[model samples]
Structures are given as C-alpha cells and as structure tokens.
Target: MKIIYSLFVWIIFGLMTAFLTVCGMPFVIIGKNPFFMLARLWSKISSKLFLVRYEVEGLEKIEPDKNYVFMGNHQSYVDIFSMISIIDKDFLFMAKRELFSIPFFGYAIKHMGLIPIDRGESRESLKSLFDAAKKIQEGYSVLLFPEGTRSEDGVMLPFKRGAFTLAVRTGQQIIPFVIDGSYKVMKKGAFIINPFRKVRIRFLDPVSPEGVKDREMLDIIRARMEDAQKELGSIGAGK
Candidate 1:
C-alpha cells in the first residue's frame, strides 16, 4: 500500500513539475522570482500528497529584507521540500554539487538559486562557502545543513564549522531549524515512502553574529541547534 502511494505521489509531482517548468519559462525569461513562486506551488502539492503536516514556530525572530544564514539538519530528501514549504523568505539552498547532474531537476535547481558545493575537495567547498556568503551579503538568505550529510541514526549529528564561518564572513544572522519526524517517514537508506506518517518543522530563534567570533561561533550555533532539536522531543519516529 505504501509503495503504491509513493508511486502515485511521485507521478503527480512529476506531471506538475513538467507543467510548472513550462509555465515558469516566461517568468524566468523576465528575470522575475519564478522559482520562489514555483517552489511554493510544488511544496504545497508535495506536502499534501505526502501527508506531511507542516508547522513552524518563532518566525517573528526573522527580520524582513535582512540577510540571514538559515541552517537545518539534513535527514531525507523530503527535508528539501519541507524547507521550501515553511520558509516564506526568498533564499538560496547550499546543496551537493552532484545534484546538478540530474536532468531537468539540476537545471531548475541551478536557475532557482541553489549554491552547489563539492564536498570532496576542501578548497572547492571553501570557495562555494564564500560564494554563499557573497550571496548573503547581496541581501539573499541561504539554507545550509551543518551536519554535512543525512543522519544514519535519528540523533542529531555534530555540526560542521563551514556554515558558521560563512555566517561570520558575511555578517548575517543565523536561523536554526529543526525538522522532526521525517527520519521515520523516509529513512536514509529506505526506498519506500510512507505518507500515513506526519512531520513537523520547528524554527528556532535566530543567532546573530554580534559579539561572536569565527573561532567560537560554530560551537555556539551547534549548541543552540542541539537545544532546539531536543525541544522537539522525539524527532526520530518509531524505528
């Protein structure tokens, strides 16, 4: 039953995506915010199809038109859609470079303002991080996963310092987000999609770069994120 549902949802997403691609062409050509609107549409439909109930707290902590570094834990691919669903701000996502190899999805992601990092090479990763910082300085928000990869276990992983360094370099606020209940719905190595399950998105308070130096900022952000994750209770669904 779950397999069938997954197939159905994927089919719907594919078709809608095709249609959106065509509809988005005009907006893209005009240099309008096509991907932002497109992401919202896709997120709404995908959330409904997956039966993922989205909730957010602490949105008031975010300021308007201010640059920010939004960081969330990585779990499932669903986390990508879930972020798009909840975040109202127009932002760029820092994702793996391999995603660019995907056919239409890669093109859309690149055009949609996603920053790609080659994780295997430190120099390349630093360059991408700096580019992301430049984007933040240009008044655009950025979404990064400090864990660097999805969790094999449900527990939160130690954060990498790259995101913090980027925030310090760009002098932007850092917003820590906790995504609860996605690990069980779609585990790291699982192929099945279970829509009967529900998920929650918890946005914690923003961490400012004021008085924070580069050396200590990563630990501060990691501790804050860990505290927020704990507040969500059992983020890991029943295994």
Candidate 2:
C-alpha cells in the first residue's frame, strides 16, 4: 500500500511540476519573477500529497523586507520543498549546475534568477558565488546548503566555506536554519517517500558578517547548527 501511495505521489508531483513550469514561462518572458508564487503552490500541494507535517520555529527572527544569506544543513530533497512551503520571503536557490540542465525545469529556474554553481571547477564555482552576491545586492535573499549535498546517512556533514565567503564579501547577515526529521521522510539516494513524517525547522539567531572573517563566520554557523541539532534530538546528533 505504501509503494502504491508513493508511486501516486510521484506521478502527481511530476505532472504538477510540468504544468507549473509551463504556466510560469509567461512571467519569465516578461522579466517578472514567478518563483515565489509557483514554488509555494508546488510546496503546498506536495505537503498534502506527501502527508508531511512541518513544525517551523523562529519565524519572528526573520524580517520580511531584509535580504539575507540563508544557510542550512541538507538531508533530503524534501528540505527544499519544506522551506518553500513555509518561509514567506523571496529567495533564490544556489543549486548545482547539473540541476539547471534539466529540460523544462532548467529553463524555468535559469530565467527566474537561480544561481547554478559548477562545484567541480573552482573558478566557475567562485564566479557563481560572486553572481549570487550580486543578487543579494539586488535585495533578493539566497538559500544555500553549506554541506553542498545531502547526507546519505542522516548525519550532518562538515560545512563548506563558499557560503560564508559570500556573506562576508556582501556583508549580509546569515540565518542558520536546522532541519530535523527530513532524512526519515526521504533520504538521499532513495526514491520511496515516507508519509506522515514530522519535520522540524528552526531558525537560529542571525550571524552578522560585519567585522568578522569568513572562517570565523563559518565556525560560528557550524557551532550553532551543531547545538541546534543536538537540541532537536535529530538522527545522528551525537555522532
């Protein structure tokens, strides 16, 4: 029964994505942003289909009018959908270059101002981060996974420095968010979606980059996330 339900969810998700992509093209053509609208719609639909419940905390700490560099730990693909469903802000994703190569979806994200990083190439990756900094200057927030990829074992990985560098260079405040229980819903390298899972998202106090070195900023965010993970009692917390 779970297998059948999972299959049904995927089918619906794919169809919805295709439909929304086509619908968003008009806005993209006219140079108006459609990501926030379509992304929220997609996320709301997914929550219903997947039976995933979200418990978000610390929204009061977020100022809607201010742009930030939002960094978080990655565990599953569900993390992306979950954020889009809850965070009420206009933010762009700094995704991998490969994701931007997908046919229709790629075209939509590219035109919607999403930054793609070629992680395999240092120069290109740096260039992409600089471009993301420009987007931040334009009053658009950016979401990045400092782990750079999802953890296969539900354990949080070490943080990367690229996001911290961007924050310091742009003097943007960093909002470190922790996502718990997403790995149990749909872990990396898994296709089956587990329903009725409770995922907790907590936003930590914003770390200011002013007068802080990039490495110092990185340590601050990581220490906060580590403490938050332990507090949430997430899987692999002590490991």
Candidate 3:
C-alpha cells in the first residue's frame, strides 16, 4: 500500500513539474528563473496530496526585503515541503546532487537554481558555497538543511557550517527554524507516509554575524534551534 501511494505521489509530482517547466518559460526568457515561483506551488500541491496539516509561528518577525539564509532541522523528507508552505519568500534550495536524479522533480529543481553539492568532496562542496554566496548578492535567500541530513530520532543534530558560512560571507542573516512531527509522517528508513500528519514549522529569531564570527554564529544558531525544538516538545515521534 505504501509503495502504491508513493508511486501515485511521484507520478503527480512529475507531471506537475513538467507543466511548470513550460509555464515558467516566460519568466526564464525574461531573465528570471520560474523554479523559485513554482517551488511554492509544488510544495502546496504536495502537502495537500499527502494530507499534511501545516502550522507555523514567528514569521511576523521577518523583516520585509531582507534576504536570509533560512536554516532548518531536517526531520523527514516532509520538512522541505512544509518549510516552503510556511515561508512567504522567494528562496533557492541547496540540496544534494542525488535529488536531481528524480524524473521531473530533478529537472525542475536544477533549472530553478538548486545548488547541488557533492557532500563527500570538500572541493566540490566549497564551490556550492561560492554559488550560494553569489546568489545571496543577487538578492535571493537560500534554504539549507544545515544539519546536513535528516535526524533519524528527531533529536536536533549538530549543524554543519555551510549555511552559516554563506550567510556570514554574503552579509546575510541566519534564520533558524524547526520542523516537528515529520519523523512520524515518515522517518528515515521508513517507506510509509503517515496520512494527515501535523507538521509544525517554527521560525526562530534571526541571528546576525555582524560582530560575531562564522563559527560562533553556527553555535548560536544551533543552540537556538535546539531550544526551540525542546520548547515545542518536538522530540522524536513515538516518544
């Protein structure tokens, strides 16, 4: 049953992505990538199809016109869509190169300015950071799962420095957020998607690197996310 449901969801995603590619062509021809705009649309459709109930807090703290490197704790594959559904901003995603292998989903993300990182190779990973820095200068925010990968137990993992580095280097602020209940929706190593899962997205206060170093900002932001998760009682599902 899970496999069938997964296939149906993937098929729908592929068709929608193909259509979005064509629909976004005008924006592409006009010197803008349509993937950014379509990401929100795709996220909305996916959440509804999967029976995900989305909730959010702290968005009112975000300032208008300010680009931020939004760091999220990955709890499940569901985190990506849930984050997009809550964030009301135009941003690009920095994801692994493997995700681009998906049929239409990969094709669309690659064109929408998704920065693919070869996580194992430092040299290639640094290049992705450089690309993200350039995008930051161009007035676009980047969404990154700084924990590097999803947490199997829903406990906040130690964060990597990529998002923090890019944010500091490009003079952008780091906005930390947490996703709860996604592990129950579908945890790592689980193939079944939990229907009508209630996933919560809580935006933390933005941390600035003005007088602080990148390493310090990383620690600060990680602690902030950890605190938020605990406050929200967002421990692993089934706990």
Candidate 4:
C-alpha cells in the first residue's frame, strides 16, 4: 500500500511540475512573478496529496513588508514544500546548482531568478552567496538551508558560514526557523513517503546582523534554532 501510494504521489508530482513549468515559463520570460504563485499552489497541493499536516507558529513575528534572510534546519525534501506553503513573503531559495540542471524545472527556476550555489567549490559558493546578497538588496527575501544538505538523522546538522555571511553583507534580519517531524515524514534515502504525519514549523525571533560578525551571528542563530527544535519536540511528545 505504501509503495503504491508513493508511486501515485510521484507521478502526480511529475505531471504537476511539467504542467506548471510549461505554463510558468512564458510568464517568467515576460517578467512576472509566476514562480511564487505556481510554487505556493504546488506546495499546497503536494501537502494535501501527502496528507502532511503542518502546525506552523510564529508567523506574527514576521513583518510582511520587510525583506529577511530566512534560515531553517534541513530534515527532508518536504521542508521546502512546507515552507513554500506557509511563508507569504516574496522570497527566493538559494538552491544547490544541481537543481538547475533538472530540465524543465531548472529552466523555470533559473529564469525566475533563483540563486544557484555550487556547494562543491568554495569560490563558486562564495560567488553565489554574493549574488543572493545582491538580490536581498533589491528587496527580495531569501530562504537558505544553512546545514547545506538534509540531515541523515533527525538531528539538526551544524550550519555552514555562508548564510550568516550573506545575512551580514545584506544587513537583513535572520529569521531562524526549525522543522520538527519532517524526518519521519520522509527520511533521507527512504523509498516510501509516510502519510498523515504532523510537521511543526516554528519561526524564532529575528536576529539582527548589525554590529555582529558572521561567526557570532551564526552561533546566535544556531542556538535559537536548537532551542526552538527542542521545544517543538517536547510539544510533539506531549501530544
């Protein structure tokens, strides 16, 4: 049953991606924000198809008009869908370079202004971060997974320095968010997608980069995210 369900979900996802890509590319080429519109629709539909219930908190902490550097822990691929479904801000993801090589999907994201980071090469990665900083300077918010990749275990990985550096360079507030239960929803390397799971996302208070060093800002954000993860874990446990 799980295998069949997973196949169904993937088939639907592929079809949706192809359809959206074809429809969205023209708008993107003509200078429209179709990525956000189509992406949010995709995320919402995908969440329902997977039966993943989201319990999102701390949206009130965000100022709708202000641009921010949104950082989150990496747990599962579902984390992207979950964030897109809930975060109402106009934000672009600083995605890995490989994603941009993915045929139709790649073309759409690239034309729509998603920043691609080459994780393997230090110089290339630094260049990508600077590019993202420039985008933030243009009043666009950005989402980054500071852990660099999804966690193999449920535990949060140590964050890399690039996100903090970009935040400091752009002088944008870092909104640290933590995801609890996505690991169980779809663990890394798992073939089956677990359905009817509850995922909690809590956005912590924004940390300022003004008057702070990149390393200092990284530590501050990591501590807050860790604490928030623990709190969410306890809450989930009590349920």
lDDT of each: 0.79, 0.87, 0.81, 0.86
lDDT of 1 by residue, 116-229 (tens): 999999999999998897787777899989889888656777777888888887777888877777877788987778776667677777787877887698777666667767
State in Å the error of residue 130, model 4. Answer: 0.8
Q: Estimate each model's TM-score.
A: 0.91, 0.95, 0.90, 0.95
lDDT, candidate 1, residue 198? 64
For model 3, the run of ten residues with the poorest summed lDDT: 230-239
Q: Positional deviation of 102 in candidate 3, in angstroms? A: 2.7
Best by TM-score: 2
By summed lDDT, which 10 consecutive residues of candidate 2 come out lowest? Answer: 230-239
Q: Could you give candidate 4's per-residue lDDT for residues 1-239 as a string of tens digits? A: 99999999989988888898899877766867587788888889989988898898999999988888999888899998899889987689988889999977897678668999888999999899989988988889999999999886668777898888899988899899988989888989887999999998899888889999999998888878877878886322110
lDDT of 3 by residue, 85-173 (tens): 77888888888999999866777788877889999999999999999888888888889998798889788777787778787878788
Q: Rank the candidates by TM-score, best first.
A: 2, 4, 1, 3
Clashes within 3 Å, all models in order? 0, 0, 0, 0
Best by lDDT: 2
Clashing pairs in 2: none
Model 1 residue 10 distance off true place after TM-score fit, in angstroms: 1.8
**Which parts of model 2 are misplaced by more than 4 Å?**
237-239
Cα error, residue 204 of model 1, in Å, equals 1.9
